[model samples]
Target: MRQTCVLLLFIVLTSCEYFNIKKTSPEAILKEELQTFNWNDVDEYPSFSECDSLTVKADKKVCFQQVLTTHISGFLQNEIIVVTKDISDTLVLNFQVSETGQLKLIDAKINALTKEEIPNIESLLYESLDSIPKIFPAIKRGQQVKTAFELPIIIKVN
Candidate 1:
């Protein structure tokens, strides 16, 4: 009787998942998921109404950039900017689209020569952005998210 009881207890303990398998807590699983998540990438890029029809991710991005460039170019072309020397440089515009679909300029990196030639370039860029159509914020994990972008604007004058 003693031998049989010991064998039964041993078998019961071995067959029970509580003793054999390791159980994970919800907090631990959540922490692991967060560690593996990529925060820098968004599932969908921000878009303008005109770009909303595009299906491909790359195409949508290209369309958004093209529209933005066009708007800024149009605004700048209307201004009479006279330069003494030929100026050919690129300006990097850093901006952000908020989750609420509002656009804001973070910074503008203009070369010394460009700034000397066009003192109001920053204001002009802001005005151009103001003229752009309403934008849709980026989407990540099915939630609207803010996104930052750096756009290069080429300034070429004869």
Candidate 2:
């Protein structure tokens, strides 16, 4: 009957396994994934304290700080760079992480803060970010959410 055909059509349309498809990342696929993910998670990464937040979004909890314990030690041979030019010691590096947890540098800039006109401000911030060997991303539902991180590295010349 007509009712039977209409029912079959509705079931067929709803049962398509399209939305359940597992997406892969690549030049073209990567663009599509990023475009979709961008719309899904509108909430910012969870912060310990919030000034303007109405309710704490604790769902974005992080297990521990990213620790970089090896490799980037004095073995890397990092030394102080002299001021042959008007280079600011305060460097801000914006880094992005891929799905496989590889770091990709997006941008880096020299000291923006003028308080660095003080003594050894650059050395202190740089060492802290560099100290962590392995970077930890904010974890949500046991999945690593794509986010940018800032690493400040300063080497004391004196």
Task: Locate the minimum summed-lDDT window of 10 residues in model 1.
Answer: 14-23
- Please identify model 1 stretches exceeding 4 Å from their true place: 1-10, 17-23
Tens digit of per-residue lDDT, candidate 1, span 56-139: 988998998888888888888898898888989988999899999898989999999889988888999998888789999999
Candidate number with greatest lDDT: 1
* Model 2 per-residue lDDT at 130: 49
* Cα lDDT computed for each candidate against the true fold: 0.90, 0.46
What would the TM-scores of all predictions be?
0.88, 0.34
Clashing pairs in 2: 67-133, 67-134, 68-132, 68-133, 68-134, 90-111, 126-152, 126-153, 126-154
Using TM-score as the measure, the top candidate is 1
